[model samples]
Every structure is written in structure tokens, then in C-alpha cells.
Target: MISLKSPRNSAQSNVSPPVKLLGSALIALTVFMLLAPLVAVIPLSFSSEKWFTYPMPGFSLRWYESLFASDQWRGAIANSFIVGTAVTIIATPLGTMAALAISRPETKGRNLLLLLFLSPMVVPVVVTALGFYLFFARFGLANSYTGLIIAHTVIAAPFVVITMLAAFSRFDFRLMRAAASLGASKMTAFRIVMMPLILPSLMASAILAFITSFDEVVIAIFIAGPDQRTIPRQMFTGMREEISPTIIAASVVVIAVVFALMATAELLRRRAAAGLKG
Candidate 1:
């Protein structure tokens, strides 16, 4: 039998060496450009010198010690986790529900609703901050954790929705129908069949929502009170007022903790996949 593959298609599928080298070079350059600042910052965070200087005198964890020792910084760290957790809790379910409804083939006004849900992600943070500030001030929520959590949830929900929608796109709806045909209620079908299949995506979305809220400073500045200061807000204030090594140390601490958590999660996911395969 003659091969069905066309020469042009084969040529396109097998990229030229020069093109591949160029693409690899571009990718490496992009990665370096993105990570250079972080690489610089991470080292500086461990510098023994009081001020930022290249070729530091020695390494020290004094900044980290100072950060943990400070009442304000410690409180800010706690507040960050509180707001992030609350935002993740509120946004995850809401986003999942919205995604489920919008992903349905029979859903009406899906595009419009999706746009509405995603408007926060599309709009500028400053614009969202201003709107939240005005709206929150009217209700005496301008300087509260409640306002901060609510504001963060508005922005973070879009990530959850996007992640969930992507998972839903890959999911087979037939399993849901089959469960329903077997006399399972919609809720039962979701819990038994859909949830297990999409649980990884659900976890990912929650993590994204938490990260979004934790990293958000513009909205926190507009909404959070002095008492409810978050890590990002505190970092912003530190940058404006004092460029202390503690700020860099805080960055390192946050980066390390989050990275470790995500790495562990990935390991667990891989193990689960391997076990299932086994």
C-alpha cells in the first residue's frame, strides 16, 4: 500500500533544524528574561549586608528573623492567609457553579454570562480597585477584611471559572448522562462521577484563586484597613517607605512556601496517577 502522508504535511510536521534551534533559543532567552529579576532578588534576600549590593559580604537570615519578629509583618502574613483562604472558599464554588451552567450545551446567554464573569480579569486592576473602593465605602466596608475578601473573590473567581471550563471542555458529558439514567440525581451524579474526574482541576482552580487573592495589592490597598493589612500591601508599604532586606526576605519566604506546597501537590498527583495506572 502507498503511504497517505503528503510531502508538504510531512515537511510542516517535521520542523527544520534551524527553525527548531531558533525556537529553542527564543524560549531560553524568554525564560532567562523572566527569571533574572527573581534570581537577583532571591539571592539579595539572603545577603548579610544591610543594603542591596552585589557580591555581598556574607549570607545571613537576619532579615527573615526580623520579618517574623515584627508584629506588623507577622500580622500581615496572617491576614494574607485569612483573606486568601476566604476568597478561595467563596470564589471556588461560585466559579465552579457558573462554569457548570455556562458549559452546558443548552444554557442560554452563555457567552454574555461568561463575559460578565470574566470582566474582572479583562478590566484594569486600578479600575476594579476604584469601583470596589466606592462601592465598599458606601457600605462601611472600605477598611475591613470582609471588603478585601469580597474584592479579591471578584477578581479571583475568573481564574477558577477559566480553569474549570477548560476541565469541563475535556470531560465527557456521557458519564453524567449514564449516571442519571441509572436513577442517580444530578447532585449524586456530580459527586460520584464528575467530581472525581474534575477534582484535580477543582484543586488547581482553588490554588489559583488563593494565589490571586494573596498576590493582589491594588484591591487590598483600596479596601483593607490598617488592622487587616495583607502581605502584598505590607510589601508595597515597605517599598514606598523603606527598602529593607526584610521585604526581600518576606518575598523569599512566600516564594519558598508556595513553591514547596505546589511541588508537593504535583508529586501527590503523579503518585495518584501512577497508582491508578498500576
Candidate 2:
């Protein structure tokens, strides 16, 4: 039989058993801590009892049924998708442009501009939400779908900017010159030579933008009208007005969907990175 162990693996195997056990235990503990609340809520969502309780009397899909069949829940979900998609569409291109501008060697104050672009992620949500409320109210934009979409775009754009910045950092800009020398126009070069190389990162950034918009409730609370309530806003209202297990069911579903999106985004990011290495 061939020896399969690499030097790195053999060195790792030389670590003390106690150290490995301790490391494994810590990781398990951390995972448990992070997942405990979500796991607890999931079971309650499935409880047959109308009220939240431990050791549920039975199992039922009543909450899940309410989530899908009810008009309010269904409307809120539709609104969330609409706003999230709009935010993604607006943020992705704008963010990619911003990243391109900042990545140029001739661009001055790149660090300062990058900081301003990413300020949304560092600022308090309430402060940002309040600012949106005040600014949009002046134009009668608050509580409208347009206002919600704009507010979400502001929040979501930062993630795209961050993702695209990293992508641009790994990108080779000389390809533009190469294409231009081959009788290609700037737009043609970007469309044919540059965009394909950066496409995976673009997709990953778009996914992140959508997820950011979908999960945001603070901006929605301040800017969204009664007719523009998204899932997060609806879930918040449910928690405040009625602690229905339906909210829990909605949350579980949202979590699952977000996790899937995040997983796909990570996969795309890795593929982009692999392409760069290759």
C-alpha cells in the first residue's frame, strides 16, 4: 500500500491527543451555542398547541399553513422579494462601478472613498434608518415601496461594494489594454474580456445584496408603508402584536432560504478565487 499521509498531515497527527480533544470540544460547544436558539424556535413552530410551550402536546403544520395561506403573510413575502430583487438590481451594477473606480491606480483618495462606500456597515442601523425616514419624509417617499427599495439599496450596496472591491483586487486590469489593442472598444472589452472573468464575484455580490435587503427590518420599519411591509417588518410586527407560532414558522423558512443563498454565494466566491489561482 502507498503511504497517503502528507508531511502536513503527519505533523498534525503528531499533536497531543489532549490538545486535539480540547479543540474539538471547543468547536462543538461554539456550534451548539450558536444553533441552540434556532433549534429551540423550530420545534415550537411545529407544536400543535396554539400557544408557545415546552414539551409540545402534539405535532401539527398549522403555523406553516397560516404562513402560506394567509393574505397578510403572503403579501409581506411578495413585498420582501420585490424589494430585495430591486435592491440587488440597483446595488450590483452601482457597486461594481464603484469598485472599478476605486481600483484604478489614477484614482485619488481611494482609501477615503472606500471608507465612505462601506460606512453603511459600520454605522448604527437605527441612525441610518432614522436618516432615511427624515430624508424620505421630506419628499413624501416614506412608507412607500419606492422608499423601501431605496433604503434597502443603501444598506445592501455596501456588501456588494465590499465583495466587488475584493474581486477587483484579484483582477488583472491589463486585459482591457489587451482587448483594446485587438480592435475592441472599451464596452466590448468589458463585455467580452473583463466581465466573464469577474462574473462569479458579481453573482456572489448580488446574492449578498439580496440577502441583506431581505433580512433588514430597521429601515423597513421607518420607511416602509403599511402596504410595503417586508418579511422582516411583518415578523417584527407579529412579535410585538401577537406572538404567533406562525412568525416562528416564517422565521424558520426564512433562515433556511437565507442559509441556502449564503451557501451558494460562498460557493461562487470560492469558484472565483479558484479561477484567479488557475
Candidate 3:
């Protein structure tokens, strides 16, 4: 009684249950708020309703049927795939060459050259599109598949260049010298000593170029017409005439495909890093 007890150790006291409940409720509310719109679309895509109303009344697969039946959609998908594949095929090697040239040990003004190569990625897509439109219009390239592929390649190549540049930067020059001293031909040295080291980055860069070309829209719009419309272009046009849940379904598919590609790229990168470590 004379000596007062030490102050209560409130610091050791358990957090109030109500406070914990409130925190969890807030977190749940935040997650729902972020995902609600996306979740809402899945049901609406299946909704029997003809309009874009939320909290669908019932469900049907009519939109999926309509999507498959549309010749325009099929044409657009084909066009996008063709353009994307062509862009990847052309861009990857060119980008790798450009990166190698720019990264050469004695290259003067390498930064400026690198910046020039990367300009497409830095510049606004709309500006690039407009410039290409005018340039191609002069050359009668507008609305042609060739022009569309070229335009997309311009944008996609930078991604490949940047990725491969990173790989090139990590290269050890001693390996090249060692191979040469061992009497290997220059081409053989590159193929045997350098190619395997950089192959992962090359693959990753090609995948990125493909994705960039696949999703490109601004340049496509400027160059593509009825004959060359891409999937994104089709989606853009579809918004003008009618709204349907099929768009959501298509978007979900695109997202899934992109997610898979990104996952693969990550795996490749990790493998490359591990190889380097070894």
C-alpha cells in the first residue's frame, strides 16, 4: 500500500476485438471495391438481359455464341495474330543487332544512339501514329498490312532492344577473347560462347515484341481499315455500334493470355539469372 504498484503494463494488453474486426472489415471493403467492377462483368456477360445493366437478372451464353459467329471478329483476330507474329519475327533480330552495335566498347555517342532507337517507346503513341500515317499516306502504304506491321514493329522493337541491351551489358568480354585465343572462328565463338548466354533474354525480348504488336491500337487505327482491322480495333469499333458482354469475355481472354506471357517472361528471367550465377 505504501509503495504504489508499478504502473499497469498496458503495452502487453491485447488489442480490442472490435478494433481488429473493424480493421478486417476495412480491408475486405477495400478489396471488394477494387474487384467489384471486374467481378460484375462475369455475370453480366452471361446475363440474359440485352442491356448493359449490373446485377444481371438471369444467365445465358448468347454473347459467346455471337462472338464466335461474327466474321468481323474472326478477321480481326487473324489480322492481329499475323501482324503480331510478323512484328516479332522482324523486330527481335533487328533490335538485337541495334543493341549490340550501340553497346560496342568503342562506340561514340552510344547514349544518343540508344535514345534514338528507344524513341518510339518514349514518344507518345498517338504522335508516332500520326507521323506514320502522314508518311505512309505519301507512300501509299496506308491501310496495307505491310504498313501496319512496319508501324507496330517500330514500337515493338524498342522493347526488344532494351531487354537485349541489359543482357549485353552483363556480358563478359574475356569470354570472347578466350574463345578467340583458343582458335575458334569469330562466328563460332559468338554462336558457342555468346549465344547461349544471351538466348534467354532474346526469347524474352521476342515475346515482349509479340505482345506489344498484338495489343497495339493507335498505329493500327491510323493504318488499318476494314481489311486490316485488329482485335483491339474491332473492340474500338464495336463500342460505337453496340455494347455487349462479349467485349468483356474477349478482354478476359486477352488478360489471361497476357498474364501467361508475363509469367513465362518472369520464369525465363529467373532462369537466366540463375544461369549467370552458376
Query: What is candidate 2's lDDT per residue for 91-130, written digit by digit as tens?
Result: 9999899888888989999888889889999999999999
- Model 2, which residues run further than 4 Å from truth? 1-25
Candidate 3 C-alpha lDDT tens digits along 20-68: 7998999999999987977776667777888888677888888877777
Quantify all predictions' global Cα lDDT against the true fold: 0.88, 0.92, 0.85
lDDT of 1 at 78: 98
lDDT at position 254, candidate 3: 66
Candidate 2, pairs of clashing residues: 143-225
- lDDT string for model 1 (144-231, tens) is 9888889999999998898789778777898899999999999999999888877877887888888888888899888888999998
Ranking by lDDT: 2, 1, 3
- What TM-score should be assigned to candidate 1? 0.91
TM agreement with the true structure for every prediction: 0.91, 0.91, 0.84
lDDT of 1 at 157: 96
Whichever of 1 and 3 has more TM-score, that candidate is: 1
What CA root-mean-square deviation does each model show from the true structure?
3.2, 3.7, 9.2
For model 1, the run of ten residues with the poorest summed lDDT: 269-278
